[model samples]
Target: MKASDEFQAPGLDLFSFPPLWPGAPYWLTKPTLMAVVGAVLICVLMWAAFAKPKLVPRGLQNIAELGYVFIREHAARPFLGKDADSWMGLLLSIFFLTWIWNLMGVLPFVQLPVSSFLAFPAVIAFSVYVIKIYVGVREQGARDYVGNLIPRGLPKVAYVLLVPLELLQNFVTSLFTHMLRLAANMFAGHLILAFFSAVGFWFLFERPTLLGVPVGVLGVVMAIVMTGFEMFIQFLQAYLFVLLTAMFIGASLNPKH
Candidate 1:
């Protein structure tokens, strides 16, 4: 038989998961379960870390505190400043939950990132959008909130162009990009990893030949390298998502005139 007959490349089907059980609903797929698991894991970790205060933190508490401090300083404080502590709970959850969602893509038997599904990131981004608008309106008043979208000091005629542009950017573009950024990264990363892994599996195991062996080895090597790189990207995406959230909230609270 031809080697080509035995080897098949992975495709978009890699991202499409079936229900976990025979009778499960369409929504109860691997990604959905993993998302719920990620949320629960975050809650458990937070409870374990903070439920019992300790003067000298150790083990899980120490590790969790390190993550907390990292988000506060890098994600929250730099953007939210004085209000950082007040929003730590939300910021910390967003950072850790997002990280876990992305990390799921690498785990054995559960190689699907929840955020790879557009719905997951969309919901989170939409929530942040609603919160931003609410806070902006509350802090700046309805009139000022809308007015602040376009900065002053332009030619009077500029408002004709800038007004609509600013409105579209602030309301429509920001929300879509915020969600799509994270989802697109995760989706593309998972697809690349799957392709390389499929190549390695097919060439090495399913259709092993003298000529195919070297290609299989190359595929395996690339998969390993890409996995490490993808892991870094996963963490970076999580950090950026939270960072942008903090920035949006900060901007709402303190609009630049």
Candidate 2:
């Protein structure tokens, strides 16, 4: 059989899902359900971890505290400094929720990363964008907030070019990039995993042959390797998203910085 005929790699259709139930709305698809599940899971886990406080933490509390401290120290404190503790709740939610969303891709029977749906990441990014603008305006005042986008010491002639560019970068490009970065990474990672998994299944079970066995083994091995790497990417993207968020809020609060 022809190679193309033997194995058709997964495509964009892999990301598409019908409604979760018959007669359900088009929007009630797998990604939407998984997104909700992820959010609920985070809430439940948080409650389990912190619903009752302990003087010396153990089990879930210990794990949750570690995550809290990690976000506070790594993602928030560096950017927001003294204000970091005030923002820990927001930062922690963003980090864990995003990581869970990305993590859903590897889960059995629920292997769809919610962030792969642009709408999910877009919502978070837009929310942060609004908060950033609001905090900047509130903390720095409207005029100063806008003025802060333009660096202070540029030559007057430089303002002609720098102002528009800085404005665009701060207002438009940053928002879109923030949304796209998370969505694009999860989308591509899911596709890659699907492709490798499909290859292994196709070659091994669907069309087993002496020549195809090695290729199938390679596919399985690569899928395993990619799964590990993808998990790291999932966590890293979550961290980066929260880090950028803290940076945006920090910049708003300290425009000169």
Candidate 3:
């Protein structure tokens, strides 16, 4: 058995998709379609879950109520304090939307997390950035907002350098970090899951050999293990994404201590 006979690993090209339609518009790739579909599905779920308030909460209402509590407690209350319930709707939407995007990656037919693509997360992160700034301005007057954002206790000599740096940190750096945190996790998770699935498929069926049997089994095991871990990560990332958003809003609403 020469070294060359061993399987070649998959590369980033695996994440790339050619045109779904050779002659159609270029933007209509699987990831784009999936993202749109996921958004629509979220709208439907929200409507179904809470269109009319129920006295006792059955089925979807029960689920919706639980979600409301979870999002308020975990993503909103700690940051927003007494004003938590006021922002539950937006926080809930962000949490569920991101979760659905990630769940798509693990679903049988749809194997890609739309958020793995940078555009989706960037859009949401930028939206949060815009809202955070807007709320800051509205809550603290333009002058005070700027005054509150930069570090307070620093010496006057440090202000010359720190002001611009802190402003950049508050806006631009937060935007980049918010988007990258979500996208990078989804991208890496999708790649890993795909790698193991590919290994299992290739070795167990496509070109089965005595030497490949153990490798194939290992791949299957790893894929399962990673899938469980990825699910945990998916939930955690969604929480973190919204938690950061709440923090941003909260920070903007009140001066830093």
Candidate 4:
């Protein structure tokens, strides 16, 4: 078969999978199932690490302790400062869950990242948003919270433009961007992988010819290299998710007036 005849490029449809439960809605599908699995994995890991604390950490506890230190120093401290320790549990969990959710994109059979679906990342972003609003109102009082959102020393005239922008920034845009950041990265990464994988399969297995053999080899190699790159992006996005959450929480605690 001619290359054009045999090879069909993948598209957004590559992300769609028929539901495991035929009647289930589009939102309840493989990506969601993988998220559920990621949560279970996190629970088991935490249990192994801290089910019974030891004065001298070893094995899973050692790893978990190291993770705690990483989250505290890297994710929490820069934003949270004195509040870091108190927020460790929530930040650590969010970091790990987001990390694993992105990881599923590259794992062998489970090649779908839950965060790519938007709804998966929505949970974490929405949770952080609620915490930010609640903490701001509870700690600063409602009027102060609104005042804090407005920049100090601004001319009275500037308040008209700045207030609506800051209000939208704090309330709507923050959460929307947070969710989009994670989902867009994962979605684009997975789609790239699918494209290269499809190319390799088309040239090598579907309609291989001597002329296309080298092209197939190149396609597979590129896919493998991109997969490794995708793994790094996944971890980075996960860390970023936690970092932004901490930043938002910190702002709410001590708003930038």
How high is each candidate's TM-score? 0.96, 0.97, 0.93, 0.94
The TM-score obtained by model 3 is 0.93
For 1-257, candidate 4 gives per-residue lDDT tens digits of 66668678788886777877878886677877898999999999999899998999999999889978988999898888898899999999999999999999888988888889988899889989999999999999999998898888979999889999999998899999999999999999999999899889888998799999889888999999999999999989998999999999999887778
**By TM-score, is 1 or 4 better?**
1
Q: Is candidate 3 or candidate 4 better by lDDT?
A: 4
lDDT of each: 0.93, 0.93, 0.89, 0.90
> Which lDDT tens digits does candidate 2 get at residues 1-257?
67766578889998879998999999998888889999999999999999997999999999999999999989898889899999999999999999999999899898888998999999999999999999999999999999878888768999999999999999999999999999999999999999999889988998889999888989999999999999999999999999999999999988773
Candidate 1 vs candidate 3: the lDDT winner is 1
Q: Looking at candidate 2, what is the lDDT of residue 76? A: 93
Write down the lDDT that model 3 would get: 0.89
Q: Clash pairs of candidate 2?
A: none
**Lowest lDDT block of 10, candidate 4:** 1-10
Question: How many clashes would you count in candidate 4?
Answer: 0
How high is the lDDT of residue 190 in model 2?
A: 94
What is the C-alpha lDDT profile of model 1 across 1-257, one tens digit per residue?
Answer: 87668767777887788899999998898888889999999999999989996999999999989999999999888888899999999988999999999999998988999998999999999999999999999999999999987889989998999999999999999999999999999999999998899899888988899999999999999999999999999999999999999999998988888
